[model samples]
Target: MSGPVWAPPEPGAVDVHTHVVPPATSFVERLTATDPRWARLVRRADRDDVADVVVAGRLFRTVRRVAYDLDQRHAEQAARGLAGQVLSAMPELFATWAPAAEAADYCRAFNEWLAEQVVGYDGFYCGLGIVPLQDPAVAPELLAEIGRLGLLGVEIPCATPDAPLHDRRFDEFFTEAERLGLLVFMHSVGSVTEFDHAMAGTGAIFPARIGEALAGLIANGVLARHPGLRLLASHGGGGLPASVARLDFVRGMAPPTRESMPEPAATYARRIWFDPLVFDAAVLCLLIELVGTDRLVLGSDYPFLPVDPAELLRDPRLPDGLVDQVRSENPRRLLADAPGTKHEE
Candidate 1:
């Protein structure tokens, strides 16, 4: 909200939000017939560049070579002038509805596979592992293993199984993540079944759900308690930057909200990281105004949305030197500050 105050640095950018679907062969081999609501690769008879991901006996979505082919991804990155990417699992693979044990197994296999990919690719990729939030008891163990596997953090949906993100059920998991200094990437899975029509087609529900989840987290005091936990909200933190004023107004009139929040909701939001994927330069400027430049990182939602990071940084509306921070320095700060890494700052 204030004018950009910090000086910028170099131009190399690190994307903090990118999704990957493991190779279909590996996905099938890891799951047995009894696995719950698993994803299966369906090769199209006619196309070499595309594949459909089938989950629970229905087509989930279509993906391209960029989703699994690192070589192709690298080529795209070179053309776009990106330095690297932080990889997260496809949102559909979350499968939070599955039984806790089964979900944990799926996550383990995925994390192991991701770790292998990160190791093989070395500097090109940073991985965020999945945890079974449906089963809170097993989540801490999974979080621990994610660290052991050399992942910088864990990726979780905006909400858990029985409760929203602010619920007490996830306290232990957040505590452990904070203790371990892991980053928590909050992504939306478009699973709000109540709004079937909205969530079913066009996938417009993701941004709305992301916003609701963020509001829930703030209203429920999760940020207040786990101040040290590093959190990243995808899709420009949904509508949070624009809704801060409304939230502040409501907080003043709402006693429950006031009691739960010791500071302005916008203040807590300012501490969280957000990716600049809103697709509008004006919106991006507002986001920086609301949360400050340091909170933003270059996240293109690569292979899904063909975002041009250089174009965004080159926007004439932005303040001097701000591009350098969002394009490179901010992401480097995030990685350096993550737990279990020698790059602590």
Candidate 2:
């Protein structure tokens, strides 16, 4: 068989789903020394080269240098043909179960650290600040600070302890994000306890959780109400495209679903953006068929092996133009449209 048609990426192509961590020693020292409240809530296991962060009793192990080492990350980006990497705090750092004020402080520190990491790497690095969604009222102020710090947008989880993202309490935050043109990069890392049992063995259930979260957002009219919101769903939108037929079937048969959702799930799915991390040619083709080329962007889940866009781009099934769009044009478009971003012509 012939090799896949290839196309060079445009300058400044972006990887939208990478993560960053605060310097382990400094983060632990700052919280422990300055704030007793946060000190009690966080724990650390420090090794020579890496640290394991335990927040609210959940362990995130072995955060490596690639998470915060700019030289290493830049070298990796250069090797992978990425012009920029969009950085968000690792999802475990959210700590939404803490008291609202404490959560805000934790999120603030993470955001500040992210801002510092992105400094001097203007065109090659863009940071997505974290917000304390447990306190919805505080989100707007934090988002404004993110913009002030020259970060690109905000990264939020699919669900919090209190509610899924569609709940009315989050309406103000979503509205502000839409009004400001912020890119709402929705990611999931199994924060919900019920999912712990359901997702117990293999990690398969994590992506499914993302699908459920997207379903809630669309069914409850969040996407409809805020059309301008630039939402990007992680992990190939978590079974969303594959489930559309079933969802549409439910839309026709279920009275409550029909009443709540004016359009089919596939209609709303098309409105949102997704990363090309599905890792299969057939599945990627299905995603493009369902969501269209314009809505898909390259994502590597960087510093993590197994989800490589390079392999996906190598699939002979993809057209050259479609490959080009996923690698460059689409991501550039997403960034250019983000609120408070200074798009260079």
Q: After superposition, how far is residue 337 of candidate 2 from its true place, in Å?
A: 1.9
lDDT of 1 by residue, 144-254 (tens): 888887788999988766778788888999899999989999997665335444226425767777888888778888888888989999888877765678778888988
Q: Which TM-score value belongs to model 2?
A: 0.84
Query: How high is each candidate's TM-score?
Result: 0.87, 0.84
List residue ranges in candidate 2 displaced over 4 A: 1-12, 25-27, 30-59, 191-202, 254-259
The sequence of per-residue lDDT tens digits that candidate 2 reaches over residues 58-112 is 4434555676677787886777677778887777666666678867877777777
Backbone clashes in model 2, listed as residue pairs? 181-339
Task: Quote the positional error of residue 306 for candidate 1 in Å.
Answer: 2.8
Provide backbone clash counts, one per model.
Answer: 2, 1
Give the 10-residue window scoring lowest on summed lDDT in candidate 1: 1-10
The regions of model 1 sitting more than 4 angstroms off are 1-11, 25-36, 192-203, 254-256, 340-345
